[model samples]
Target: MPAVTVANPLALPRVPEPNPLTGTERPVVSVTTAPKGFEGEGFPVRRAFAGVDLRALDPFVHMDQMGEVEYAPGEPKGTPWHPHRGFETVTYMIDGEMAHSDSHGGGGLIGGGDTQWMTAGSGILHIETPPEHLVASGGLFHGIQLWVNLPRARKFAVPRYQDITSDRVALLSSADGGALVRVIAGEVGGHAGPGSTYTPITLVHATLAPGATLTLPWRPDFNALVYALGGAGTAGAERRPLRAGQLAVYGPGGALTVAADPKQDSRTTALDVFILGGEPIREPVAMYGPFVMNSRTELAQAFEDYQAGRLGSIPAAHAEVRAATPDAD
Candidate 1:
């Protein structure tokens, strides 16, 4: 075997303290609903997922709220086949069922507590459609779709997928009922997630009961954001009641402390939240529709290749693209 050497772990970056956001502290940006495409239809929303644009997050690009919602019988709920390049999409399902199919030949139904990580390298086409049960029963379908940019070196590496079931993800509990931390990726309290990630990331799904508090250690080098799934809570010194469809951006600090309202006596009123923080790419991004590339020329070439069917080889259902020609890359 050739000599092997391990690469050094990426250095964690330092983040600054967040300015207190009082009633007067203006939000950096407001979260909004995504617009429908020319097709006149987009992701179905019986309950809307509030989306935050990635402009403030830099290379992070776009994020969509595919949260819990109800649908009536025979209602249409699905996203048609779409193409993407030079990026990745992470889908976390909280409730209901979703069926995913892609040109790469991979298809599966993700039920509650499932996560799908897809790397849309070079180019790939895929679709996420709602299951019949979800359409007929009109129950809650909660989830989030996060878009992460590919580094220039890996933009055309080849598409890959990592499907992680809820049971397989790591769950860490606080001894005093302070909090429950679900490790979706990276590490928390020495616990690591099973998801395959290209970048350094720490994704955690957390829940806090009434009057409970949880403190999380932080690495200054990472960019952090929190999405409130339901109920209300406060982070750091700021006491804010967050609801579903709301997102909180945290400034870099050594640690983060969260507390649930003790005034509420019902356990059902506890707060549900997702804490996702990752190392910042700190790079330029070029995005056009579903595709994200490092430069406009590379993006144009990707479009041309997809249009010519050069990237249409479906070797296997859910098959991963291992390698491709330079032109395709």
Candidate 2:
């Protein structure tokens, strides 16, 4: 078993009593519920934060929480080969296993607690599916995939992938053993996640015990939001109670604070949430299903290129992600 270490409390920078910097006082602004949308063939998900203001949410546009649903024997479903352009897709697994296959011959399987980050720069075709082993036996599958919009200048960059395993992710803990945060990107407690982003962003998956509190600072220039995934908790200065399935879209502020409901039984209480935000890319965004570009003309070109197979294809042998059963695999 891989060892999970607790981060040193002194390693993490303490939040200033009042931000010493000018124009940087973190506050609780507006909180929005992430509307649910049945996106992939497999899960019931919610868009934790919603808005179209490109400047306010520059590098970020879409976020979705994949099913924490358990699939019965032979009932698992997933997304087939699809096309994407002008953005990056990040898949973080919480339970079960999911595999990634792409037209450029890039593929990887991230089991529970792992992450896979893919960039469909100019364009790429890919499929994310449950491994054959799980699909065959039928077990629980859960995960989250986030679509990060790219700046025009970098939209045409080459497609790539970053496979980050759970063992490589950094863990930050509170001095009292109350809060534990998994840093997927950005630094926490003097350590960082393995993701390499084109756009600077902060992404942390945190779990707090009953009454546990954790505060972290962010780039004052970036926008931020928090999505509750488990139990109940409060965020920002307002202390609004955010339970599971609630997404808090915060207004401009500096640092963010969150704590789990302390009154609950500590043994069973768990508050899970994802804190994410990034610098905005203020530019014209023309989006069609699966294609995002600066203008309608570019979007049209993307569709045409994909139809013409310009984006490439996944090898027949490696395209499908069949379950990796002991004997069959």
Candidate 3:
């Protein structure tokens, strides 16, 4: 509700609109703000667009925007060893540093705009914690963890990891010079994103200059939407003025227009939007705890394996909890 004073606001913290975009409909936007995320005791998360319906986001089941909050010295904290199966996890770092380790003998370190894409195909035990140094010195922490669905076919695919550094991702500016898009998946401005996804999708982190507009196109079949990460602006034809922390769900898929520079009389000056979605994986979803499967039987096996030592555990020798990360390997 109030201005978020983070240590670094993304520096710290797309396109055009025309006719016959081919098999696409201009996106209609509606603003929803009752809730955009759940307040974790520590980190805040959006399990399903907060107040929006689950069908809107389809494949993305959970998305957490970890604290942009400044931590007291020795206060930064994060996830510990846990089991996951039948899905993939994507972590994008905005500020600060973190260490990751998983049961599959993978590990890495990411900080300042790096990304980690992990496929927990069959199952894996992993821990994601701030690097020991950060936890001790204490500093600002800001990051996002997105749970991407694995279709029934690849639910048991072999687990793998992809470490994408900041330079590797495609960062593009709009033709108007008012917006910047940091693409992680799919393509932007004719260039491809770095992260590889089992599900065909596009993920973008866009920042708009005040009043700058980006009208981008997506397959008519994809479910497209935008989340205002910070600041405010208007989306779609309704020109529905959205406040900070609002989710704007679009209809069909076509040219989606977003204006970050609110009109002369508006609240936020800059607009931060995280855009993502793709062809929906129309399948029954069966989930329990961290495991997401198509049926209960698979869910049961996931638990059995963990209890029986099938999913490896974090090594006892390391005092600093971390897993086999993509970058570190």
Candidate 4:
């Protein structure tokens, strides 16, 4: 839970409390526990979007809560080089280090509290793994990887990358200074985070002290979802029980609420949650392994292109073969 923190939340800007009379508080639609799964090179993950309807997720396609596990030396793992298209991959490191390299010359080391945003617009090839030193020493590795769906209009946009550090994120506090909210993208309470997105969305990481409640003003149009990273809490005005690895989807409203339990487990002193939402794409979704397109024909074309070495090649620095990203739309 070392994503980001302040010793004194009271000194930060506070989120205005929603008006009880005028603001409509979003109600919890459903709470689904994420099923555990292994991803990449056999690393454990919690499938955050499991059991949730894709229409509810809209602009979002997939999400994974990567290990809260401590890896012993030589146990660290990551994905091999892979191809992606028609979407963006957002990797947020919460308590570990990850090294990223791509054929487009977009590569960097993301430490705790940092984020790597890669748009596989038309297509791209990339690999993500634990840093050499981290792998050798064995350490804590925890993070989130989210796949955001690109609208049909932008599916062929040029691939781009952005590195967003924790310091660049917008920080705010609850009116009572009981919660610390980190806005990683989009606007919240007039505060905008540094991460740029093609979709109209908001990403927030909030931590609440025991017995604290945070009420946030949300856009009526953007769908809302809250996923608990750790600790216990209640979501929405009706107070649906929520805990780690659980995701709560909300109904339409002008605001939402999350309250931390008065008592927490010995491992965690507070409640941590990841809140995200976006304007629904509302288009037919045709997705397959590694590609998200609007039609099966397009998906087949993507696979053919990838097999023909059109997506991209492993950077020469990492592999013997160096190929430029193909100019295709």
**Top TM-score hit:** 4
Off by over 4 Å in 2: 1-25, 51-55, 263-268, 318-329
Residue-level lDDT tens digits of model 1 in 190-231: 678888778787888877767877666655566666666666
Residue ranges of candidate 4 with Cα displaced over 4 Å: 19-22, 320-329
| Candidate 3, lDDT over the whole model | 0.72
lDDT of 2 by residue, 1-329 (tens): 11233456446433333344633546766566767777656456776656434455567777778766778988877776778889998888887888777887778888877889888898887777778888899977667788888888899999998888888887766656577778888664346777899988888888777788867766677788788876788987679878777777667766677889876544336787888888888788887678778999997788788778788776788645432211110
Candidate 4 residues 42-143, lDDT tens each? 889999999999999999989999989999999998887788999998999889999988878888999999999999999998888798899899999999
Clashes of 3: 18
**Which residues of candidate 3, in runs, are more than 4 Å off?**
1-19, 23-25, 34-41, 44-48, 263-269, 319-329
Tell me the tens digit of each residue's lDDT in model 3 across 1-329.
11122222333113434446463555554667634343322454544366666677788777766655678787776765677888999988877787888776789998778889999998888877778888788887767778889999999999999999887877666777677777789875467888888998888887777787777766667788787767777888667786556777889855676777544324345787878877789888887778888888987888888777787776765536443322110
Worst 10 residues of 2 by lDDT: 320-329
Error of 1 at 188 (Å): 0.7
Runs in model 1 deviating more than 4 A are 1-40, 44-59, 263-268, 313-329
lDDT at position 7, candidate 2? 50
Residue-pair clashes per candidate: 15, 8, 18, 0
Which wins on TM-score, candidate 1 or candidate 3?
3
TM-score for every candidate vs. truth?
0.77, 0.87, 0.85, 0.96
